[model samples]
Target: MGTGAVYLTLSNLKNHPDFLTKVEIVFFCLNIILFVTNSTILLLQLVLFRQQFVRLVLDPVKGVFVPLIVLSFATIIIGIINYLVVPGHLTFEFVYVAFWIYIAFALMVCIPMLMIWFNSSHDIKTFTPAWAFLVFPLMLVGIVAINVLRVFPLLDPRAINVLLVGYIFQGLGFFVTFFYLTLYILRVMTTGFLEGHQANGAFVACGPPGFTALALIKLGEASRVILPQFGLVSETAGEVFYATAVMGSLMLLGLALFFFVFGVIPYWFKVHKHLNEILGCWALTFPNVGFVVTFRALGDVFQSQLFWTAHAVFTYSICALFVILFSLTIFAIVRGEVLFAKEKDLWADIMPEEQKRLTDNAASFGTDTVSTLDIVHLGGRKLSVDGFSEVDLEKGERRPYANI
Candidate 1:
């Protein structure tokens, strides 16, 4: 799209043409900035802190996002192809369609296995908002399929059948999202707000409902397109789904928005003066996109200009936010605040000392002493500790073991 816009701009003869050249420029800049920043961070992680990166990948909560990240880019590629590449070539629809099927199926299979593995193998002390990422692929297939169907050829008789298959997964995704949402609420009410960077993770809750809302709208359309043939019900099944889906989505949107504010405002005012340190702040990006798109779906459903206007406002605003976030994230990376770098090296030479800081903080609750003898790593020294120290972190600065 970027190159295409430039080509069109150069070809146009008008002095003040109202062309989409600005969009092209914006996309070009955003693409370059995000690409460079991400590449730089990944490289740094590989070279400077390979072990930490491995630990992160293996981590139960954080690890889930890795494959989800891959799936995210796959969806992005599908979008690029749909909008930028394959519009004129209906034949090429199969290429993206096949790609989507492979990815969607892979996610359907992989997510549950990972969920079982992560939940069983690891002892989860703190449940971060990353958990919501596990279920996103559920709604993802329906979203991509519905949109692509608009332009792509009706290549198969089973397009509706394929959608039915996707609907099953979407249902599964919705259930998982709802289940975890309860856990999340319990964590907040029983445990307290996720401290430090994990607090930003609250933004993740915004995705499931919003994505599901948007997906249902498309699925409703897809059902309306095909459901009449099966004699399951009338064409009104689509409207039924749309009505319930929209109402449910609006409620979820309110909750998601509340959680967004619940997550961000306190951190801004009380916890962290700025969002410079945490990569979990990236949680702000995808979920907001989900909401923005869902709102657009609502506009289509009600045919209301207000919802369309809201969608347009949020779309640009979020893009602007993402761009600003990209800039800050890059700055954070350069400052070495994002890297847990402990040594001085040639590559690390440019990291400014003043800007070096910690970005992530895991909130802690009290732990039980399972045994009298425990091995502890403290200050790079191995200590055989005989007993545990019990202190109310919220209540007292003085530890009972302080004198001992």
Candidate 2:
């Protein structure tokens, strides 16, 4: 559909000379910018999270960490493909680079699965073992089928169908596995928050979710771009990107506004609440990066005049929620000690008799003592002993006693 749309636009441009050139220039420039920025960000993510990535390769079930690694690698692969294969002249250089990038990502994913299978004691489980097992082989099948079918007339349509089906299955599999892992993380976060275990609470409570947000943005964009070919959605990648950008940006902005209203302003009023302010600040800022990208994508897709207005309102709302939650969390953290102490005192007062008995037992047990003695004859050293008595000592004489 993307190819067809481009062709249609070209056909129409033949009649409209001035507008055509302008539109073409604008499109080209924007495409360049978008591609470069996205590619750069993908690279940065890979480099920044290299350790997390290496761990994923070694042990992919490192919970939420695995998705980010996958996201980074996948995004990079998409970028390379777009740059080398789809955009300009498909030269050998482009083919070589694109092939190598795909190979790297494939290896990153495949090596770990193979290692897991080889190392398993026949009982180990992964995030989604079945999907992992099927994806590699299916990917191979898709690649081989596409290459082989490109040679024969009858095989062309079949190859396209196979490739699309395989990609959909593989992508959907990863998506489901990622979804489950993310939900699990969120559940744990909610549990920690409810139990007032701030120590175990998420550092940002948004790390894994943020990754999902980005994925959602990408998925939405992909749906818009590709779904039309399959005749599913009216939206384009740009449109999807726009929506994701708007929604994600709003959500992130809301969190920041919330921190200020609940945490920062309150802290400013009562300077003693330092911890609350710090945590609040992090909660506000941490997720915005992902959201900003989402917004950028949205802006490209929508190209509407009121986009800024929508952006502002959405940002404010999201920020406001953060403020409320941050305040509530701060209050919870601050009052934990007081609540604990009160409960302890209540129990103590209610069980006075038991406490007294325990105290007595403890004191009596402390006062008691046990003793034992042992005697041995020395074999290595001998001493001549003079026996002395009171009268003998006074007369300066010593006496000895024999056991014989």
Candidate 3:
């Protein structure tokens, strides 16, 4: 999804004379294909593995990511608006319908998931920046609304309605994200930085504010044009909205910069230590895309060479990071290190006898050979059949399995 956002934004850069439109289109198309393929796999998993699906949604550590499924669709929708609707290659009615449909989907996913979180017990020490994902789908609604507004005339009723809803969505998403960020700060202050690769999640904290900054500035530009036509308020009210949006966006951008720096600082000390592959490493790419794209928007807003230069530099850096991460991801896939379910992931599906048999087999092979599939519990304590490590879920001390 982050790669798609990067390509989508690059394809929309009308001001950059030297950018290769053909290359951007090619990458965007490839991203769409990948998105569709992954979506199909997830759907298939949900259908064929109902128990795993339930576990994935209810597990405290993993449940926070369920909304990212909605968010991925939101990214695709925004891309359609930018590449298809705005270009007139696709009709406005199609995307407009998609916009409302997406809103319903996002609401259904985010609201229920949030309720589950609220009702469930979680240790604060287990919290990570991934909590920001809870509201990410809602925030992207603001972004989609602004993109959809571009295809309509400023005087059009449709444009006015979109602008209004955009602000409401922005409020819900941004403020809720702020609350999550506050908790994350408290968590960090109490427990210190996340250890090892888990620290990469700090980048996730940058995303909400960075994209909100982009959405606010673009929506503000739309308000400056669209609001005065409605005669619902004084002409100066539109200016006020625009000014407020800019100021709010500036503040949010500063917040995003703090997170970006906070996320990078840990890597400075532990870059070599956490080089092992995990899907979470991809966090390095998409969150920073939000920061880079926000910089691009600021460049356009201020028409400043410095902001534009910063945008260019960051864009290239992120693209380079994307390439490196993509290669590592492919390698991990081939090595069966990611995108494959572990024994623990499917534990709920296994019969008691089958689980015991597997556990016995694992024990017979010795601790050195135990993998994630060899989970066993004695009393209330979770242990690997390998005997090398133990986890107390009540205390939230999760450790990786001894072997892949």
Measured with C-alpha atoms, the lDDT of residue 10 in candidate 3 is 66
Question: Please, what is the whole-model Cα lDDT of each candidate in the order they appear?
Answer: 0.57, 0.37, 0.74
Q: Which parts of model 2 have CA positions greater than 4 angstroms off? A: 1-191, 194-290, 304-404
Tens digits of per-residue lDDT for model 1, 19-135: 544554455455445545755786787787675666666667656665554444444444455445544644545644664665566576466546554566543347766676666
On residues 41-103, what C-alpha lDDT tens digit does candidate 3 reach at each position? 878878888778778888777788888878778777777776677678988888788888889
What TM-score goes with each of the models? 0.68, 0.30, 0.83
Ranking by lDDT: 3, 1, 2
Candidate 3 CA-lDDT value: 0.74
The number of clashing residue pairs in each candidate reads 1, 15, 0
Ranking 1 against 2 by TM-score, winner: 1
Q: What is candidate 2's lDDT per residue for 110-162, written digit by digit as tens?
A: 55565564464432222222222323322332232222222323222333343
- Against the true structure, candidate 1 reaches a TM-score of 0.68
- Model 1 vs truth, CA RMSD: 11.8
